[model samples]
Target chain A: MSKKIVIVGGGPAGTIVANLLTKKLKKEEASVTVIDKTGRHVYEPGLLYVTLSDQDPKGIVKDEKDILNKKVRLIVDEATKIDTKRKMVEMKSGNRFDYDYLIIATGARLCPEEVPGLKEAAYHFYTVDEALKLKDALEKFDKGKIVIGVGGVPYKCPPAPAEIACFLDYKLRKRKTRDKVEIHYLSPLPRIFPIESVDPIVNKIFEKEGIKYTTFFNVESVDPKRKEVHSLEGETIGYDLLILIPPHRGSKVIEDSGLGDRGGWVPTDRYTLKVKGYDDVYAIGDATDLPISKSGAAAHYEAKVVANNIASEIKGIESRDKYNGKVVCLCDAGNKAIYMIILQSPLVPDGSIVC
Target chain B: MSEEPKVDRLIDARNTFCPGPLMELIRAIKEAKVGEVIGVLSSDTGSKRDIPLWTSKAGHKLIGIYEKAGYAEIVVQKIK
Candidate 1:
């Protein structure tokens, strides 16, 4: 019988693996199936630009059919549960697919509603839909205090909130409303960039841009009716427009499958990308609780390692490939771009290199 | 007349980060001649898909893709 490979999630990780597998294995030898809840595949990192209306939202979105190779089967359905014992995945559409090997790439999801009144009062730019909504809200508000708050740590795209603040600063200036709009950035961490090396540069940019930075201010709740976001430090930030980066967690299926860690991320071998318990089950991208930041680039790197190992396992070859936990991120600092590389191999403090 | 030079260039973007390797690949493909193949070796996971998608959209052909030693090699044949 032909080998059946089922991949859950059609985000960056799942799509890349599916495409690679289709290129490597002949259709007759192995069948690749990709399951995703939505047909829309958004270039999530581009959300930073989209939220600020710097890039057209349409450019960031592409149909799933457009990206998937011909050899792979794309299934549009939410994976409800993964039955490792049965080697099958149950979907919301009442379809169960059996797999000889499973790659879980179900990416992260944001829960702004978890914070009281946040969904109603604040704008989110995490998803394409949210980006569009935020763009409309920002354009309508001519002049007022704009607060960009990070709800929690380990969120997707660590530098995104900073980028948003800078882009908004540029946008307001372009509209000649810079003097009218006051922009404030609130983060849970003490520095703008988690890595110390990159913090000073980011701090300099914030100062030049005149964006107020507030650290160690954990947001407690949001009162939509009053247009106020209450922080744990007894400070309530009032805003005419609130752009929020909410807390992110792994896919519901992974949590429901009881395979995720306490933070709801899949537990995987740091190097192999294989699930801790089952050798046949592997995870990549934002789904895994890797030490790296949850970003598209990170997911893509994880996918390469996962694909190589899976192919090696199927061919009965010794897999020597291991993830080095390296990440490269691009931060748009208004007029220029700042590229940061984090090398986590030596286990340095925060693994940061700013350029 | 002799045949045109089939451009064959390999971009070793291993250990590089987002937009850095991706932007480089884009620039390399643009500078290459038509009917040439640009092989991109990227350890950054996003480049594997990003390169292929960009090639396809730009009217190029994704000839092959494979992963080795934690790096993904994607070859794009410039049909345009």
Candidate 2:
């Protein structure tokens, strides 16, 4: 009998694991299946380029089935609940999948409505629609105070807000309107970035670009009428155009399935990538509470670890592969240079490159 | 001056992106026996710094990083 392996969420992490399993396991050894809410998969990193440039949206969108290996089965349905006791997955379409091992890679969700007036007032680029909307908004603006504010912590892509500020400044300069506009970056942290080593490098770039920054500014609410952003500290910054990075939470399926914490992030073992107290269950990517940067690079490295270990377990071989919290990212500075940040741990960069 | 270490096995991960060369080296290290030297050729510049960092952190011996044309040969010895 073949072992049933079911992966929830056909995002980068899940898709990578499902494909790797096909290469690792023989047909008689296991059967792999992936459950995704939508059959579409967006190239998320390309969203930055889409918002900043006139890059066509079609290049960033791909059918999820097309990305997955032919050996793995893809279910275009939402996973409503996971019964850990029964080792089953219940879908919203009244479908169920029984599994010997379950991998949860359901990533985070952007909750713009969490902050008052944010959904209606602010602009974001976390999704395909949002990126296109923000791109249109950027084209019409010529001269005004453009404030890039972060609504809360644990948002996706830590370097994105800084990246957006640089790109916007460069765009305005190319338009011959650089001096007419003021660009400010707001963060909830005490520094420009969460990583101490990377902050000085970014601060230098901000200083040279004349992009002002405000730290310790936790966005409490957005005042659309006044065109101001109110912080928890009672400080308010007015903006003619507000690009707010909305707060993020883990997928609602995690919360509804009672597998997540208050913030909806699953309690996962940092090394083994296993959901805490569940040996047969594993979680990866932004779904885990690893205190690491929620980036695709992290998810890619994590998927390798999870896949290797699961394959060994299924083959009755002992494998000690563990996720060492590795994350490698190349951030665009919009100045003909890209910054590469690598981490062997949280909040510390093992190395960086400016090229 | 130390003599250049002999390469026991080589993993050619050239033309790959970040984490690609590093992952190939890691997987090769797992399959290697103790006291065997594993060399990985990576064109990705990020791996030039990351491979050494990973080798030291993983408690392996870093033989040397030999720079080649358009790529680098990162050699490490499996200690455990």
Question: How accurately is candidate 2 docked according to DockQ?
Answer: 0.02
Model 2 clash pairs are: none
Q: Over the stretch A16-36, how does candidate 1's per-residue lDDT look in tens digits?
A: 988888876777678999998
Label model 1 with its docking quality class: incorrect
lDDT, each prediction = 0.75, 0.82
> Which sections of candidate 2 miss by over 4 Å?
A337-355, B1-80
CA displacement after TM-score superposition, residue A57 of candidate 1 (Å): 2.8
How much of the real interface does each model capture, measured as fnat?
0.00, 0.00
| TM match of model 2 to true structure | 0.79
Model 2: per-residue Cα lDDT over A1-355, one tens digit each: 7999999998899999999989999989999999999989988989888998888889998999999999999999999999999999999999999999999999999989889999988999999999999999988988889999777666777788888898888888889999989999996655676555577888998999899988756688998999999875557899999999888889988999999965688889877999999989999998986666687888898999899998999899985687766677667877766555554433222323222
Across B1-80, the per-residue lDDT of candidate 2 in tens digits comes to 35667888776656533225665565456557789999888666767776776676567888888888878888999988
Pairs in steric clash, model 1: A300-B45, A301-B45
